[model samples]
Target: MAALAAPTWRMGTTSLFPRLFSSTQQTRFALPFFPGVTLTIPIGIQLGLPSIPSILEGIWEGILKAVPKKKTSHMKKRHRQMAGKALKDVTSLCKCPACGETKRMHHLCPHCVSSEQLLHSLQRRKAHPADIFSLAPTPNSILSASGSSSLLVHSTTESTFPLIQTIPNAHKLGCHHVCTAKGGLGNVAASVGFGGEIKIWNKSQNKNEWALDWEIPPSGDVWAVALSENEEYLACTTSDGRIQVWDLNAKQVIQTYETGARGGGSFAMSVDLSRDGKFTASGHESGAVYVFNNDAGRMVYSLSGLAKPVRAVAFSPGCKRLAAAGNAGIIALYDMQHGEHVGNLTTPNARPAWITSLDWSDTGDYILSGSLDGKVKVWDVTRGACVATHSETEGALWSVRWLPKNERALGPGMGKGEMFCAAGASRSLTFYREATGI
Candidate 1:
């Protein structure tokens, strides 16, 4: 083999190895020995063999340009998908199969829970053969009044609530109202009869029997009556709308607060004395509610709002608020200090029904109301909402009372547990307890 001569070449601008070698013209290589068989090869091919790194880099750049970079984080991508799914779920609506009512698909049926659990723990018993007019609960007993002349007493301390006694012929005409003081033993009870008379009764210390202690002759027709917590005083509403407070210990009239003569003295329908014995409140047939100051012996505030007859008036346990209800089908709450109407509690789409009775819980956190539609409602005062409702009978309910809180009888979820008794035209006493299981 003969030696071959090297040739210089310029790199072409379009070649991948433009810096490694330059080539613009083609060159030919010649073999020395064979004169007739001289071989020729291009200079660019010879120089390109040593430029493998630049060719590889150009291929990698081409691949990267064809692919895309990830711009979104994994968590951001997942959150966007979830938000879209939730929006779809919220807009979707469905009908409840059981009641054929429209409701949210993923939420519980409110109507079903309210109707089924309202009276879930109720028990009924025939306390009076006739319609029960009033109920008064002591620390250990419940006194009920009916159209019958006798007053029935039931022991509440026992689980069975046995019939303890009956005051036969206590009221020649049926008793319309009955009330007891807060103290259990040695406390007195007062009753107003249809015959326009008031009777005071005391329990026997030795025999534990109730007997007539005294009577207040009928100066006027007494329609309703209430006793102080200490049993030291009694307040009664007369047909002439006169609120008269009597000293039980002295057995004489102490003060008379009169509702001004509207329509010849609006008939006083209901009266209640504060447990603290500081105030007296009366509801009249002319839709008037008057709160009187006992110390000053005068009407302090004449509350207005209900345009229909006022049937029930009660002061809260704290004596800071008063609730009044009647044929208006709504309850008006009043602040005692300023005598201003604070708020009104009304049911949505409620029918026209007379609210006959009202009572406050021991903590004054809730109010219990009985209506002529046979529905009992528990009102949450602070929230201004009706927390529970029960309608077991179509007959009218005349009276409802909250039982004294029994600490020993409390169950789970029964923080200061609650129990109430209701009586009415159903001719049976219905007892309701908090549904702790709920």
Candidate 2:
């Protein structure tokens, strides 16, 4: 490239002007665009920016940037190419001997089989066609709800965990939350749909079928629903932050507790009743957890500490403690009798994920928590430490619950009696048991 003529400073000029770079005075560079093709560029760098004085402005046009050279060597080039090929799984899907989920012919199922807990995957089933939003397990069966307009029931008695019943078209707008009793104790089940519709379901005594029990009228945008231990009373959370207890058998509103002085309040995200039927707890979008006295029909405590939306709250089996977790990703434990923030269980990481669900073991010795990062962690309340963490899937885990400590058959590899099932955006349910106990 040829350089432009120099701008001469006239002998009698009042102000001095810097001379423009001439063709011979310029530094030229050759840039290779392709393998052999090259383009010669004049090195005319501007002396000052636009913010500088006008005297420094008039210079040759500037070539702002140059193309970078290839830095990868022959070894690195072939390593990256082969590494990508190794990462790709086989196109064929075969049933894994360990977890029963279809995977590649020789590769392990990353969703279930892992070295850590091994996560002790027992059985994995495709529970829904869409994302599984909630999981409710009865004594002998597990009920799942998804974005699809149906509910699925799988029996936990056999090793295969077969689908026994499918409630088709159960909800028009899709169900978001489903609950069997407080602790899966009754024949009754309740589900709240995205369209603010609530449906009650009951299992037949003779047949393995689930029939519609009743429907509650939508009041103030009802969302989360929970049934009492006996299934006689149902507690539901409304968007306006009011918790209402309905007499399921009588089909009437029994007790209504207003969270705010006026009427409307924060949106309640989750609700649960104590196993003994003593206290009713609700988690709100404003990070407020309210515990109400069932007998007195009044507020017991407005718990604090969590500064973000609280997603799930669960009462211990003994009714002495309550566990609450949410967007803060830290599990807070409160004394139900005094409502004091006893402790918090946080993951050992820089940024923690939102806790989506929480459930206490039958003995109330351990608390199981599921987070948005698809991790299921069991916490020892006494030590306030995570005993075990299972990362079966990389999708958000919407729900996780202990399988009532039953005689669930061990398919191939054995595991502990205390099994917990996790489900979420993966559109499947993955069950895990304790690895050491088996």
Candidate 3:
């Protein structure tokens, strides 16, 4: 047999127990090891695994660098690099709605409108709402009352929407309520204010701009007003709890209904006449909702059950139900026929948020409400459940209205194409359309 060479170690300690060449020879071999050191690992096999010597060396270097550094400049440079990377990650998520362009989501999109300077300008000029008591919308124009003092005619021509013409000082004193009949004719506009007076405005457009033609003096500051579908009879609710119906053609008070048998003078907040002009609904601050039969000319039902001041009351398009909501954060629905309380709708974690505005879809399929909590919700009338909720701000929402349906395309019940508008303490109006097809 050929002789075999033995392996040799130069410096490091070898295992204490070494294997012998023959079974008869001793197997134990005590190699020199430093004091306090205790390790005996075998070395000889060759397995095909990648060596990671460089990885271990890099990890050791990182550990040494991570310790407290003495220099302030180097630490600041490292932090700035980390912050730059974070900003880059955040800019990736913002996008624009109108053009589908990527932009900071929290910041306004530049392509849509100039928000930078306009926001600051609005802040410098504080809230100066002229106490608009009545606002009636038409296809081409809008009639508004200014605190029982003036009549302002606004043009709905600037956008696809309306713009205010702001006729200054149309009334001798501030007016409480002003409204136009169903169709925009010349002589049907009405205004009432603080003093026991009512004035009618007629637009006689000759060669120049149309101007007010005549004025009528009625009994009180009209707190709320409504008009018949035929535009013949005008109904105005006074602060003293009397709803006076006027003959627009005759220019005289036809009849008056006394509210507040549930203890009057709780200021009628809202009033509306049915589409058929047979029933009139009124909501009072005393939490009382009264429905009267204008055809029979008497009080029909005094709907009860709401405990808080009723701020908003709306009759559905079909005049089948009335929804009233207020400081209680609960919305109560009443059957118009029997004046019986039907059901209530409320948010789950309902804030004691005052209900400010209400509007029903033309089909009576949905009822939209806006509240002090700045939430606009769409309620499914048939199911009596909230279908959609949009909370855009924490400011009070003052007005919510559904745009009249398009008669050319499909009526209210047939298609899903619909639009609504909301405006409030934020000083900006928002328009929303159905996001999906019906």
Candidate 4:
């Protein structure tokens, strides 16, 4: 064909390929050799009797997608879904019958267990017919003072705390304060009465009864009193704001401390003698706390801070610091060495109530306080924090004292070796023991 050039071949474009196909799935092509001649072939025959390559590829892809993935364990699937949860709901709870408190089912009630501290009522007895004002614990007995004229002694060595004896008509006008000295091998107790008289008592060698040994006439009006460890000296606070130290053996005043001319001689409400007999401290109604040196026979330091009628003052067992409190509702601590106010212990967000009594633990680590609001608090001196509190009555608590550690009672289930007793307008003496042994 015109010396027909070698057969020409060309690739089909998408637009040209569509024209090559017919409605019947057949393809038509014009031959160059014959001017009007056309060639027709079945699409299946022209395309090798099979589906289009692109369609086959799509079908293969769909089949691959329909097949299942590699099998996975139920645990692995669950882990992927729930990965970040910790707490589980408690399905059961109930009310405790003993304490009327809500508690977890199958578990003991926390309130009842903690209320063991109040089990003190286990040995409760009417210590005094009237309100008990003070409690002083000896090695084996507790001496209680009340509005009555007699002093009641209870035997703590017995489980029932039976009344062992009573000092009849101990004070004609009724005693307001009673204290015992760590007074070497003998028992020496001192009592101050509203009649302005101070009496010294001695335990009888044959009867185990307290007998009046001697009496010291009031120089002025004796309001509060304390005895030295050896019972060799006595410290008393006067109505005119003077602290007088008396020689017990000599039966005379040996030293006197004055609080200056403030408020026309502030009323000395409380007085305490150091265990070493080297210092005497006093709290005054004019909000002044004074420390006096016995050897020098003069006032050494005047501590100021609680300006609201200081009522109670106490010295640490070491005689290194002083704690003073009163209607101010806070306890002020002072360094005896410098007479500087060191710190304060205050109840958080509580209305100020008069603190009536303060006592330090034998170890000097804790300070026990009783307040007019009938609350007793145990303060940790080193941490400056209240470690325990008890409010069994709404009436004022006048006195609180820590009992000497009892080695025999420190057995299993007996709580801490430490014990304390509180008394006041509630007309009862409540004993408390540490819930856990230290």
Candidate 5:
């Protein structure tokens, strides 16, 4: 510079440490920082390099970027949260006792737990146009009958509980009661109509469809019906208070049982066949429960606990116990061997809704019941107490059937979660599952 202007400096450099410019061999520049301030910064002017302010600004901007101030991304936050949760789960992993597989310590292993109870309704479908009267659960499907003349088959394993088949006008007037074998593996089904026609159905192996195998010669006395596990016998209740077991192969009534008298007994309202095919049970209008020795062709025991119309009756899978319920709103259990009154299942403040349907679980540990109040209940047989209850609508529930347990049908790595279906005035088939299942 020809004439050195006075080194007028108002403020010091922006650098917090002023000693950074102390080196005598480096060049010091008074950079403009504010209107009246100057920033003194050192620059190495070596090898024909110049101490330029723009280069210092570039370095300062680089430093600013090094002190990151960006917001955390959602993916990172999720990764951190999941990482926290995964740490907790690592502590619970243990070898399962039954299968030696990795399993949560507190949860039951699906391989060994067989008593998983069916709890809440998981799937519901409006199955029929009129009131649904009965439900018969096969291993993978459900058979439903309604006031409409159609017979509907719904698959349990499918999404949305789809209706797989519909037998149009299966009954001339309308069907009231339909039943499948007590054991889930049978291919036979029996349905009773309001017109007193009993139709036998057999599943076609090629198409997995049902066709009318035979129709019992018209008899107006038929009411509720049941099928034996072997699929060889069909048991039905009669309005005339008689229970008859038909030999399907012979197409004739092989055994006929009377309750009160030879011609007249209580109106047989409900009936069931023991899975063992050794006993037939019936509930009647006179509040009586009768058990017959199918092998002996004689009545074994005439039980008397329910003082109202006995509407529903079911036998355990092992045929060790029997359950009977009806207008009295109480479920009475009986010892099948000696026909002793074993116990009763009753709610503390149960409604006056008459129980209309009953079925036993596969392991004979629990029993399911449906009532006129549109409530379903599960009872623990050993505890003699109600374990769970569910209600969907206030319409009368006419039938409830437990879907049989089939390993192939359940698929691999699946629990033996008990399942059952209920149907009634809502004209819908409601499927339920164990609480643990998805």
Candidate 6:
């Protein structure tokens, strides 16, 4: 800077003088000229000004103008207050310690709500652990066979969860399933054991609990059982693929249907008797569902719709529909009258897991399903759409049933009807009711 060169100027992020033409000698030769234009003229000097960026910017803006803007959401805002109250926190609702979310109070937990509401409506509303083995609902109490060879009776309506009575050595090893009359009016009940022995129990008017009414001779390992609505007929399925029907009064295997075509697995997961006791259905591990006519004493339909091992099967209250679901994660609804596939209820992908339990609402207006993913979904059969879904737990849900809505006793707004009960590996029972604004 001996001579102190003229100070350079700078514009925003660019240089007033380009680096390539920083020297006066370079700038002189860098200027461009139009034909017949003299460099000394004003027009020629003005044209030499930098204008490449301006032209590029104009082209860029024009391209941007051709693109469209995104639209805003038009959905209405939801009211937080009512939605909050409708779901009562059920974290503390159940008596068992293992019951987690089910125990929270006031905020209805989805798993418990769906399970309790549906199962509570069944004629013989009952729940038990897989290890418990047997369940029988009496008018005023429920009898269960514990994993032990003993049986426990619980009062159905007591304020506290009280054990009414116990029977020791009720089973040689352990009973697997049990059945009672539809109404539970009489004290009669039936149970099937691992030893293939079927035992009937009855409570004397004077006795506090049930005593062994009779035990059928060994057939095979008893896997499943069902009782007629009238409690006059008892049906039991064995590992050998034989369905043994017993006359409760005559106390013998009146008829036996050889259901051998279906794959024979040791576990016949489910057995159901139609409301009218006209039909009996058995779901096997081989993914085969069989519906038998109790009146005809023969297999009426060997249903072919489902191929996955059928875990649960139920008949509608009117005996017009039969539903079966299992590991396939599909709920198949069949018309009992026409023996045609009526429709299918699909589970959402978020909860797209195995379906473990299913039951029809008392009116048959809705079908409730419990899945291994711990969700209870209420499906509107009339519309073939899911009406509501409750996330009950993160654990597998073993059972769900619609409760008998006691409409007559319900106060205002409790319109939908009775509640249901759900139970599973969680070792607790959850109750749920249709949302009533009141």
lDDT agreement of model 2 with the native: 0.78
* lDDT tens digits, residue span 93-186, model 3: 4445555666543333446544643464344222225544445555445555544354555443222333345555666667655555443243
Q: Which pairs clash (backbone N, Cα, C closer than 3 Å) in model 2? A: none
At residue 81, what lDDT does model 4 achieve?
78
Best by TM-score: 2
Which 10-residue span in candidate 6 carries the lowest summed lDDT? Answer: 5-14
lDDT of 6 by residue, 1-438 (tens): 311222221121124424323323212112243332222111111325555577799899999998989755434234443555566644434332222433333234444344544444342233333434334555566566645577767654432335668777877676666667654355778877677788888888886668887888786667777777777888777776677677889877777777775545435677788867788888887888888887788888878777778877888888998999888888888888878888788855654688877777767888888888778777888888876667756766666655444424232223345455555554445555552211
Ranking by lDDT: 1, 4, 2, 5, 6, 3
Tens digits of per-residue lDDT for model 4, 9-28: 11232234555443355455
Candidate 5 stretches greater than 4 Å from native:
1-124, 406-416, 435-438
* Model 6 ranges with Cα > 4 A deviation: 1-136, 158-161, 184-186, 261-267, 388-393, 403-416, 434-438
Deviating ranges (above 4 Å) for candidate 2: 1-70, 74-124, 412-416, 435-437
RMSD of every candidate to native, in Å, equals 20.2, 13.4, 15.5, 18.4, 17.1, 12.8
Predicted candidate 2 versus true structure: per-residue lDDT over 384-425, tens digit per residue: 898777776899999998886666344444343667788999
Tell me how candidate 5 scores on lDDT: 0.77
Better of 2 and 3 by TM-score: 2
Query: Which wins on lDDT, candidate 3 or candidate 5?
Result: 5
All models: lDDT? Answer: 0.79, 0.78, 0.63, 0.79, 0.77, 0.65
Off by over 4 Å in 1: 1-124, 182-186, 410-416, 435-438
State the displacement of the C-alpha of residue 184, model 2, in Å, after optimal TM-score superposition: 4.9
TM-score of 4: 0.71
Which is better, 4 or 5, measured by lDDT? 4
Considering only N, C-alpha and C atoms within 3 Å, which residue pairs clash in candidate 5? none
Candidate closer to the true structure by TM-score (higher is better), 3 or 6: 6
lDDT of 6 at 193: 69
Candidate 3 or 1, higher TM-score: 1
Instruction: Find the 10 residues in a row with the least total lDDT in model 4.
Output: 2-11
